[model samples]
Target: MKKSRYIILLPLFISLTIPVVFALTSKGQMLENFKRQEKEMIFESQTIFLDEGDRNILKTYNKLNVYSSIGDKIQSKREYLEVQNEKINSRVNSLESSIIQFDKDIEELVIEVNKINEQVVSTKDEIDTNKKTIDILQSRIEESTVILLEYIVYLYKKGDYVTTDNDIDNIKSILLSGEKIDELVNDLYFKSIIQLTGQQLIEKHRDFVSRLYVKKLELQESENQLKTLRKQGILERNILDDKRSSKQRILEITKGQEELYQKYISEQLELERDIKVKELKEQIKLNNTKKKLLEKYNCEFVDIQVQQTEFSALDEQCANINKIIFAESRLSGIPLENNPLDWPVNPSLGISSYFNDTGYQRLFGTDHDAIDIMIPMRTEIRAPMDGYVVFIQPVVNTGYAYFAVKHSDGLVSLYGHVNQIDVKLYDFVKKGDVIGLTGGEYGTNGAGLLSTGPHLHFVVYDEEEYNDPLNYLNLSYLSYKSLPSKYQFKYKSDFKSRKGFEYADTSKKQSTSGSTFVIEGENELERQKYLLGTYAVGDFRNWDIWVEESIAGGIDPTFMMCVGLAETSLGKYLKSAYNIGNVGNNDRGDTKDFPNARSAIAAMTSTFNNKYLGKYNTINQLSRYGNKTGAIYASSDFNWHNNITKCMSHVKGEYIPDDYNYRISIK
Candidate 1:
């Protein structure tokens, strides 16, 4: 029984032990499978599949299968991948070439745009110049047309048909061809003949012939009178010869009588000598009286000499005293050494009327000797030339006043109707001195009667006679020479005048402030700040602040602000954007709809950057963060990077951040 139990137990133990051994072997195989899978996965992750055909085909397969299943596919894939990589490389090269070509085309387009802009500006300038030329031409043409029409009308009125036809033809040519017309009216052919019609011209010619015939008849009558006078003169000459013969006979008869009288006179002289000797003795008695008379005469002569010597000494002393008085008077401003009258008034004064034959006399019958100046009341009257004040007093009968200034050149300036007398008679006055004001008691109506409306009835005369003041004054003489024949007359007016146009008051007001409003003081600063704020947002249309500042500082604010805009874009970056306070690069992102505050700042800052930093260094570095990509982009960082050293060099005492990473963050 024991032997049978031992055999069964042994067999059971052997069975269990065999099953355990198989389970251990299965576990070992599972661990090996996991290890192999892990190794494959890691290998697949690291390696790249190469292919020649359809370069993207390897990308579609599992990395493990790509290595295991690769046979002809592997060789073909390798060849295909080699061919594809070559084609891809070629395509990349072509795209690179196309991009380069595109860049070149863009540069050329920019140049072409600039050229077109230049052409546009040139065309605009040319158009403006053409417009100005056209305006000038139009004005000239209009003036010519009016003149031509006037000439045509004059010819028609004058009834000069032939001259009118010639003028009209010329005008028609000018109008049709737009040709230039002569400026000289005298040169025009029809100027003189255009005043009469054809029939009128014929009548005038007949009248001229009749006048010539009458003049010839008068000349014949005068010749006959001369012949009759010659006959009378011959008869008178014969009568005078007969009288001369009678006179010669009388002279021969009287010659012997004079000789007889001479002999009788010789005997009478001897008798007279004897009588004269007795008379001489009697005259001796009176000699003493004659001697006394001679003595008295000598005494009278001596007294006369003494008196003459005393008179000479007294005269010399008087002259010396007079000279001393004159010197003292000049120093004291008492007596004017020289005539103080300033330059003559109305030197350049416009002429209203001239000394013409028109019976229009200011002093009634006296002809108007000088031209009238059509000036307003209180017009500053000055002496035309250097002169001395001869007389300054009122007129005799007339209430009008006048002042006479005698010039060194034998000319006199007479001012009449003065209302005030600033300088006394004989007071020295220089040219341009305010002698008197105009229009005080003289009303406008009286002013017209006294003179022609507050005018300085300026009269120039050489010898107190009527001479053309217009010629001496270098004034227009058209009105003076156009006087009528019957009105020609001359008269002398008084030079002394105290009341005239020269006396009118012309004091000006002290201030001239009007109704216009003006801001002053601290309000100006507020205005400037307001302007700066307004300009920061780009709304700088109104130029009030600029105008005010320009007026204050005396500078053109428009030009200065334009320069600043070119420099800092009107301080836009110096301030802050509405969206992103004062932070720099705050609005940087790819979101198209988001606010590009940083871009605006960058654009403004870039201008300053280009000015401060060199194009090759800092600007090129900044281009990396921009849209362009190239070797230039690859060499620089994407963050805000600039040549701080270069920037600081350009602007001394200006701080440039060393840490570029935080620069954009810190405002």
Candidate 2:
């Protein structure tokens, strides 16, 4: 605490200079001008905000900055990134589908080409075998023809004698005449068996040549097919390369956009700081003037200290915060506005404890500074006034989440024990707009601060002092508009939960408790919980919580979702097993369990990014892999790629689930 001063003495040099300035200075012209300007600035602020109007006015006036909270800037930047990423992702997926199809086609062509190669090899081998058979037959036929002719000639020479003599068994007698004849007969009967006629040998040779010619034609046809396939593969690959470059360009452009948003945020922050500094300077000037007035009033008293010094002494002489203005009544500021503040929560204030209530007094060291409005979890908490949210503190070390809104005239409203904050820090919110939801009471896990039950801890502070909320609220307008049980009102309301798509069919999955709907949310972890039903059956605990998170590292959401669905059955874990790629199978004759989904998904996507990012543009390329056997993904399941593609369609809302038969009233 600062010590109170009764009087002050001016230093000798200070008093000399003060007399000089009083004689020579204009009659408060500068001071009056300053006061007028400050009052005018305040008046102008009430009617207009510099940020909402021409933002470029800051540059005109040399302000050099705009005022926006860093948190709000980050959030705004993030939303931009999300929307942009969504657009880029859509294009990428479209192009990638084509690329993947091309790959599949190319793979089929390769198989065809390989088959043609096999046929060509086989045909060439057959042609060679046929030629050798033709050569052997021709050699045998020529030798036999020559021997027959020689025998015929020899017979002619001797025919007159042999035939005229009418020799018995002339052929057998000729063979017995020499060992050569016997050898020829023995060879023909043994190894040769039945020698083919000369005409038969000639016909067989022609048939082999004809077969070889036909095979050569077939080989030429296969070679032509191979050439066509190679050309097509090259064309498809070139197209795929262009698509890949397009995606990369999109990524780079998105990165630059994010930087632009960040730069704008930085400028806004700097402007905010400058405005704050300027305001502080003005306030200090006004305070120092007030001190001079206070010192003049001190002369009215007869304290020795007051008699010892001049009225316009500086702090060096008086050592006082304010020289003479000490009474609380002299420090009255602007009065509250006539309009009443809106109720901060859906629940009425009468049902809960008021500020400084008997129970509140004992629970805390002093009477409660704020009213406690008891409301159920996830209830919409609204702002009492149009103000900018200046703070958001997430839960930390067993603490609950809380946020603060800075209103006009230094009035700040703080909300505690909240969850799922809808407004980011520095977000300008209108009256009755959602700021956050009520949290569980002080001691409840995740309730934020000290709470007794699911309720909102609302406090209104002016600068540093706390004010009773009842003072600002109009009881007539905001009294408890409820009957008996809060649950009946909470559950029966028509507030619909968010769905993934506009035409999403979630009726079949709807429940009376409003928990079973598997759909999207404001973020990823929420989506995982909804998809896996970790809140329902806990078949294999929460899995797939890392899908969107992996996207930050360049993983595609559709690819991840499809793989997760196909591999782990949307993390249903029916087999009580967990595998990100759905590839790992336990050897225990049963399904296995994983500790968490995040690490598993990380490991899986990391491997994928490493293996297929630049090399492949489609999931089919991942399925029928060409690396080492162990390195190949989904090789065992021939339909792995197809199943994943189908799942992707489902995730894209192009394929509705068969069980989505239930209906709900769309709001």
Candidate 3:
């Protein structure tokens, strides 16, 4: 009974233990998976951050925002700087204008000062002249006074009034005899005569003296008037001196003003220089700041990458936990699957050409690579399968309108000659989704080089190579026989050949020469070696060779004859379809007839090689066919025949040419 009870308890214990073990194991696995997934997420984030696309996006965002901010700041600063500069300029202009005006004033003042100095000099000369005149007048006045006194004393000593009078008259005559003073003083001296008798002279000496005194007084008054005149002359001279002094003072003031103005101009110039220097310094600082901000943005992007990685890790951990918990939740659930095959167009009309063999070449070669279904103009075209829109190219030569859809399993279908493309690239499309409509006569037939008639060319490629959709679909050639009569396609009988020659000429004219070659040196060996090297390994589609021999011969290297061998295998082949020269078409010409083969090869080779490479002299020297001096023959002195042999041997030989070492030795 106890054993049975332990057994029943064991069941409960096992159940509890199993769940614990499972939970622990799941938790550990979830943690481990989370760590692994987190590391992967971190690595992916790092890769994305470093990838060009993501880096460009980040860089653009940073550049745009940083540049915008910097630009805004720069604009604001520029505006402010402009205002400040204007202010400084205004100050400078004002200062300069004031200096100019001051200079003008100084010039005027200088002129005035110069005039004052001249006046001062003139005044000093006039004062000196007046002083000399005053000195002469004083000496004359003193001499006249002394002579009159002597004459009065002589009359008293002579004891004869008449003699005294005579003596006085002699004195007056002497005093009046000098220049212009003689007329005025002669008249004044003669106006009152002095006489003294012997008796009367002694008795009435007092009375005579008195009379003489009165006469003397009158003479003294005239002398005083002369003195006053001299005083007035001195006063006038002083006034002129004062005027000259005032003028000198004004000149000094004007000179001082000029100096002050110059000082102000110097100060203004220095201030402007200082302001400019400050502005340059600020600009440098702003640029450094912008650089620092860019560095910070880079750091921020790195931090964001780290954070995103952390978040992804956490999300993965939580997802694992949920998966573990919900493993059996959908065990009995049903899944829905839908497979839809889309028609290429709307079902408004029947398919004129079914996807099958029609016993003839349609468009893509001897066997049609695609199915041609005739439709009306402007008919809507749709997607044939649920896929992603891969390409929508509207190239003129290849297709009038074309769109491609990429499905799962590397399957791709093309709809050509479309009128329009409504869907965008990488768009997820379902079957029967409308892409575009058909239009133009060109769409009906391929048109120009590619043509048949108005029909939709539907092609499906598997893994990039063209494949017959009918074969892949495992359908019969006439599987649509059971369908309605409208869906059947009518086969053409005895159709005329298209005018393909005109189209070929047009295409040739339009085609561009796609390759160029250059010879390395002026030596014949170098030229031959260059041709051999290029022709042996170069792409056959577009090829040309240049040599220095053309330059020495005064011909363009582009027109060199031997260069065509690199393309047409030395006159062996001519491409008739595009009127191009190639190595593959050699078998078409008669091998027995050397002239016909050579002529055909030479004509095609000359046309293409000359057209593209003739511009340079390097290629012209290598021409063995078109030299004017007839030096290109096999027996020419330039060893033209030997060079061709060397080139052919070098290119065709499995190892290096036998002459290569000998050529090196000669060099």
Candidate 4:
């Protein structure tokens, strides 16, 4: 019956995909694959926790907000602060569990397949031994038959002749033949039974082969399913890795900011609580309220400002406090307060529109309150001075976000269109520490309100009033502005071909061959390591090597540095789809991914030099050449030539030649 069953399933067995050595060789492969997945799971979990640690650190340093109530009275207003990719993580954990189960299943299948293979081998050996015994039995039966026939012949001869002495001997032999025949019959019967048993063993081996074939097919299907799941798991893990990488960079900014803010708050709160200072503030408020400029308890802004429809209740209160403080300072004969500030961003092409630009005035029916400095999306928005964040919120309806920092000098810098806030509220940040990332445009990083594209709306709260950032920074805000691109050309596609622009030739080889990277007997790798030490995350540390490669490709390393800074916000937010320059994503938001950052860098620089070398020898010419057909690099509101030049100057810590592109040496 078992043999019959195997025969019925035989045809299907031929199509089995799993190898016959599944127990020996393929089992090891499955185990190794499972182990690899296990390692990856461990690594990903570690990465996720690393992000949690950073968040916790930020929470610790930022002020903690706690509330207490006694007898139905609540004292709520005190200073302090504080990827839930929970779904992705849960799915990952689940995947790990399933993979573990799959491993166990494969192990069991391996054991079962091995046992069946052993039985088949043993069955085959039994069949071989039985065949030898059957052959030996057949030889004995043949010899016995020959002897019986000889006896029969002798008997016939003796019957035909008279009974002589020879005949008598033959008759005795015939009697002996009968006894031999009996033994031979028994032996032949035993051999027949042995042969039958060997046949059964052959049938049993067929059944074992059929069972192995079925298990192989089953194993193949199961392993394939497991591999598919693993493949998807890998892709999801990579996405989480990218998300984690972005967050890690933000954590670095928070490290400086949160610690500083905590110290500032702790120190300032202690000093302000002194009896004399408290009495002085109370006296000033009391004296100021006696005049018509303020009401007794509400001595902040002008009475008319309180009546204004544009200001929110919170805005009015804040304004009023500033007003009262300013009045007190003035009465005491204090000068209007100010801070010597550098441009928070680059020397912007120019203000997209000044603080309280007309569009805002129309919207709020009041003056615009911030200066819009045009910059790329994800540009690093630095702290204007040493300060702590007092407010951070997402005004989704307004189409952008904003954060406010209270400087120690009684000044405040409010930056808007910021989609990403690295520091929590009350976290202290230094004058030049990156506190957040810039965002604007209707739907780039985050949606924006009246904003058309990426730019920084910078404002200052000084002398109890919102002042122009332009006034403080004193930046060169040229009357005319446009995009900060060397040439203007509409993108036909984001993935432009490097081969299309391979004609730009360099007559002079760069003076140095990666010599600049050999700092203190350390090669480019060592220099990159040192440079990357300042960065919180090491994912992008390898990018520095691309700087060396670009120099070899005949582009200035200085310009490459500036371009990387301007485009990637100093790696704060990388489009991995992009090289340091997001040439892959046109300003219009058409994003295309490259294989990796290094290959993308090589391709972009090669194409850039090929297209622009001879045609636009100088930065200024590149800036002014948009009038020609297909020469549009920047859209509007800034000139790429001037912006990159200024940013390059900032990087070099000095001005470069007016004809920067044409200049042979940075020094």
Candidate 5:
């Protein structure tokens, strides 16, 4: 069980100690030093108390009813912090239990090592006694050997023993004569006694020598056993030291983690407090602002016309209209009869919220007064009609920039959530004139209050009351879907004809005989394939035929593909009838449809080759003329050539120029 616990902690030990080892010393001595440090340091249980003030702050803010998203975010953060704190506490508890177990293990190992030490000392004492006995036995054996040698010498001198045959015969003849029988008997008895004594002494000496050798062997074994016990004791002590070190290291790390978690929890609580306070203050400000806006709307405005002297003092600026290209939609759906106002932005960009949209009441705390036109940040906000700039908020980063245009019809158009404005107050702007860039991305300048995402809030007011801007401008079928069902209108296939742009006559057939098209780079075909695959242009998955045909027709294949992108988003918005480029779209909204993507591509390339490529071979050259595919092909669209050029640069892996001006000469 103890070993299993150590095994479980092995990974933690390595993880905690290895980094310290690397930070302080070389790899060779890192582990050794860590072990030493851990063993030497004393460890105590760490108790980290939660800060009451931090807890109270969180509890106080959490109790208050905050309906804003910020409040919800703070609550979520608090919950996450709580979870983290609980996890930390759990881990600390586990580490403390592990440390306690290690302490117990260390104590056990210490006792075992001491017992081994006692056994080792006892074994050493036995070995010493055995050595002393072996030495005494050796001395006794030497003395016995000397006594036995003296006895042998005395027997030889007394002639009590004989080995020669002549001496034995003489002794026999003397016994027969019976002259010294008694003396012989006496000598024999004394010699036998002396021989017995010597034999006993030799046997005793052999026994002592054998016992001495046995003692010496036993002493060697005892010394070896003592050494083994000492080694075991040392091993136990090492284990005890390792356990102590492990416990100390765990305690130290747990203490540090506890402190860090406490600090983090405190900081999170403080942050929550600050956020709640800020939200409360902003709520008050927003209520006041809303009240003031309501009062302002209720009152009548006196027109303050700017004199020539005052107008000349401010900078006169105009908005850039070419930055945006309106997507294809039914223009006839919009009501334009006797309407001075036009669309402030492309209707196809869609609307997020409408006037008095109840969906917005929860966020704004009131009925939405204006329509929210959904568009990306920095999109150009255009003048809907010929109007004079009546009010302009020029602050760029205060989130309060907006401008109002007073139209001749006594209607006012207010554009809000604007970051950049070009025109000064009292400046006259015609319809479709660019005014400024729209904003509303969160935390960005001009996002103002209650911005969920990027969009333009467009408001209109008559002298009497606030009016829905949708009532004044033409609405497309696409944007019509974004409004409440009451404002939506049924569509008719036979819609009115659209307005047209100036164009040169195309009554005569154009020839492609003079056209000479060139591909841009050596690797352009492969590059175009990669770009098409990257954009997942499905129509061009089998695009080799389209590219070959386009190249054979003396037009850049990339430009042809770009034309496809410009018209249909590379076939995403292609009409179901399979006209990839909307090839023959005109003012009446009629389009030529092919049977397949390849046929469409071929027809588009051929049309470009015959009509436009004969004069303008390159995209730059084609775009150089007024926005009508060099004033011949698709002569109504102002953004056609620009879009194609942009796509050409993009697909060819060239820099897409930000400048939308297509009039500049290409180098």
Candidate 6:
């Protein structure tokens, strides 16, 4: 019985110890997992190792996918725009035809109206002549009536004269002797016959006058009807002309809109193609080694599906990383220098994400170690300082490409998401040397597993620990408006007044003045060149030559430089080498090349003098788009004139502003 009791107790003790052991094991596993997760949170690319065949397959697949997708989009968009443009062309043709017809109809109507007017004038003249003739006939009729009355009175008086008392016996004697009485009454009888004939003539004249009056009334009525028809024809012609003008105006507006839309689409597509093609080329370069290795090993392509893992604890650890970076900044002996480094990218493109951004951590599930610079994909990446490339990791399918440079004075810079690197390991680079092309496209080659978009991930290390890049770069060139409110307050003292032009103020100087084209003194010219960034490189380096040549060619030196900036960003990146002005000879295929940049400048001045001088001499005149000269100069871009003139104003140093959006593209 004692043995049975001991056995039951042993089972209960085993049950109690089993749960405790299990709980302890679980706690140890959780602690290990937390440590592994913390290690994965940092941007470490050392663990990503791929076989030769798999790397080639991924590189090729990514290239094909990116190019095919972009190509398809371009083709579809171009087709859609073409279809719309065709419709607009057809409408314009129809309107043009209708306008021609309207003009012809209006001309014909004017002729018809003129003919009707002539007929009305002739009818009026005839009415006037008829009135004059009727007045003459009425006067003759009155004269004849008065003479007839006088003759009647004279005959009555003759009868009274023969009634004397003695006449009775004498008249009886005369009647007995009738042959002698004929002489006495003959004169009276003749006068009375003349009067009767005159009265008959007057009656005929009155009838003729009545007929003339009726004809005059008919002529006047016909003239009034013809005048009404002339007015109607004019009204109809005016209405037709108005419709033609309205339609013509609409056609012009539609054509202009079509050009602008086509240009916008072309620019957007061109930018995308440029980025993808460049990325593909760089990938090909990177895969050359893998291709050789694959052939040597005769390795088959292996498909591996990588699962993305997430750890909620990583965010808290990243916050601690930020603290470590801040502590390093304080421990370092190096103080902030005044503009120690040139901007890696264009200053016009402001920063997108700041270093140690809290908002970035909340959205991305990790703290950002570096600043993400805003720029288009495939933009040139320049070294911030003279340094030697120490480390380079070209990204594969699940890894990001980045390169680190060991700069002087214990400072190190790592440029991340670089698809194309011009420098290799241990290669020395200058401060402004183009090291590689930028890459951060989602799912594209060299874009890491956690990339949000296309941007430069720039990180600076102060004594081997991560720090802010802004500590080295000049903050004065940056715009206050682009910074966050907190940053604005923090860097308020660093903001300086720039001498460049301001876009907000309209009262600034214009390009019309002759002084606008000349940078007054030598010192002023250098200052403007430095401000515009043209003094650093290219043909503008020989600024004295530019000024002398411009003056010889009858163009202003300042305006010429501004045009160069507008066309090619001061020859920083040109579409065609040595074609500084981008002047075309009306042939799209005509790519003219000058021997040197100075020669190209000379060619530009010559072209302007010979082709465009007398006609489009002024900036305002050249800006009249759709005019003879404006369309020839820049048909694709409507803002060409505004851009050039704005550059000119900036160069003259007339726009001194307290604050400006320095990131805006003045070109």
Global lDDT of model 3: 0.41
lDDT (Cα) of model 6: 0.54
Give per-model CA RMSD: 62.3, 35.2, 53.2, 37.5, 44.8, 42.2
- lDDT score of residue 520 within candidate 1: 21
User: What does the lDDT come to for candidate 2?
Assistant: 0.48
lDDT tens digits, residue span 1-667, model 6 = 4553221111101111221111212323432342233223222321123343433443443454455556666767867776776677556557667667767866776776677667667766765775676566456545644544444344344544434444434434545564322222222222233245544643343344334333444445555555775677577667657766765766665568578657766876786678678667855754564456444444422221121132222343332222222222222122234545677777567787898675565456455667898778889999887666655665444346677775544577888777677886545577799999888888776776556788888878776576788877766566765664445433544554233433331243323332222233333355555534522256556665565445434466667776676666566656676676786633466667666766677667666655554445655444343243443455533356656655555565444221212111100
What are the lDDT figures for the candidates, one per model? 0.38, 0.48, 0.41, 0.46, 0.55, 0.54
lDDT of 1 by residue, 1-667 (tens): 5554221111101111221111212323432343243223222321112123322222222222222233323344445544554454345435545545555655665555555555555545555554455455445545544655555445545655555566666656655675433222222422344434433433333233333333333344444444544454444444444444434433432444334444444555554555455445434533443334334333221122235564334443232222222221222111122222333454344555556423233224335556566556666666555444555543323234556665433455666556555664434455577766444235532132235455666666665454666444322222222322112111101111212222221343221122111222222233334434444444333334333222222222332233233223344543334221122322354222213432333232233223432133333343344324543322234322233222221222223333222111000
TM-score of each: 0.22, 0.23, 0.22, 0.23, 0.26, 0.27
Model 5 lDDT on a 0 to 1 scale:
0.55
Clash-forming residue pairs, model 2 = 389-426, 400-448, 441-451, 441-453, 442-450, 442-451, 442-452
Query: Model 5, range 503-563, lDDT digits (tens) per residue?
Result: 2223332221112112233344555665455443565555564554454344555666766
lDDT of 3 by residue, 336-369 (tens): 1221234575433434444543333322324445
Per-model clash counts, in order, read: 47, 7, 18, 21, 1, 0
TM-score of 5: 0.26
Which is better, 1 or 2, measured by TM-score? Answer: 2
Q: Against the true structure, whose TM-score is highest?
A: 6
Q: Which wins on lDDT, candidate 4 or candidate 6?
A: 6
Per-residue lDDT of candidate 4, residues 49-92 (tens digit): 23343323222211111111110121111143111222333344
Rank candidates by lDDT, best first. Answer: 5, 6, 2, 4, 3, 1
2 against 3, candidate with superior TM-score: 2
Clashing pairs in 5: 399-446
Scored against the true structure, residue 568 in model 6 reaches a CA lDDT of: 64
